[model samples]
Target: MIIPAIDLIKGEVVRLHQGKFNLKRKYLYEPLFYIQKCLKEGAKKIHIVDLDGAKNPNKKQINLLKEISKYQIPSIQIGGGIRSQKDIDLIFDLIPNAQIILGSSIIKDFKNVQKWFNLYNPHSIILALDIKFNKNYEKIIFINGWQNKSNMIFEDIIEKFLNIGLKYVLCTDISRDGTFLGPNINLYTEIVKKYPEIFFQASGGISTLQDILNLKNSGVKNIIIGRAFLEKKFTIKEANLCWQKE
Candidate 1:
């Protein structure tokens, strides 16, 4: 699935560098704009990250998210500012068809992740394994909007989450996100091979249609498309067309 991304800051569409809010470039579009535009371009799903909520767990742009969800453009997955079960409940109550993403909170409070999944069902939640390589090339998970780093190996984290009934993981390589270089094909391919039963949502570094095709051909079923769409490097329309002909 080629899912277009719509990142919001102060309720406006923007793109951050490697998921960093301090260094961000605001785009000239509303949250609704991407919903309608990406859908027009044949997007089957959309990825929305609340940069504001990621930065401060207490804050959120839920109203904006609610508005976007009401459009029924496609199945949506939302992340950031999702700390408790109540938050998840609110999202589901307001946007019934959306998936609630758990990122930093899972690192800080994994018990809640299990509890929420048991309560709301694991099928509606998506986990993020946002990671970076250490000096010795050891993969470490980063959370809290990519500001804090954990000493845990990336694979172990994914294993633990999958054991807890996590099926869809947004495995993002922070080093390549928003860079438009290309996705970490080797990383995703390896992870998929290791966890064939789980669905790994390939994120970060998708620059061209070939990148999408490469990932798809390599067994990646879900790919997140971000800055490329905002930058006009390729249209969602083109992406869908490629998918059809290929």
Candidate 2:
């Protein structure tokens, strides 16, 4: 699946280079315009992240989300700063069909996250594992808008979640995010082969059709494309065709 991504800061569409706020790039279009365009281009799912919320849980883009919900888009995955039951409830109320993406909260409050999985359908929540490689070449998870690092291991985190009936995961390589270089193929390929039961959504640095094909060949069933689509590397229809091609 070619899921288009829209990152919002102050209700404006933007992209951050390698997860750094200092290297942000704002786009010209509004969130609704981008959503409508993606839908028109055959995108069945859209990934939205609230940068403000991720940086500070208190500052979630509620008004913007409310406006977006008016479209009644069913397959939107809303993430960033969703840390509690209240946040979850508010998002569901705004966009009833949205899948809540849990990032920092998953690490900070694993027990609550477990409860959420039991409360809501496992598929309704996506565990976002934004990771970076250390000097020792270890994959470490980063949280709190990628500003802080957690000592959690990649496989260890997934193993814990899998026991709780985790069905969806969106993993991004922070080093490659917004870089337009390419995805972490080696990392994704290894993880996909190891955990074939979970639906893994590969994100970050997907800039070309070949990148999509490479991931597909490596057993990745879904990918999140942001800058690639925005920069016109390829259209949604073209990416879908590539993914659907035999």
Worst 10 residues of 1 by lDDT: 155-164
TM-score of 2: 0.98
**Top of the candidates by lDDT:** 2
Instruction: Put down candidate 2 lDDT per residue, 145-220, tens digits, no spaces.
Output: 9999997978889999888899898899999999988999999999999999999999999988999999998887
| Pairs that collide, model 2 | none
lDDT of 1 by residue, 20-92 (tens): 7777888887878878999888898889999889989878987787777669766889999799888888988
Q: Give per-candidate clash totals.
A: 1, 0
TM-scores of all candidate predictions against the true structure: 0.95, 0.98
Shift of residue 130 alpha carbon in model 1, Å? 0.4
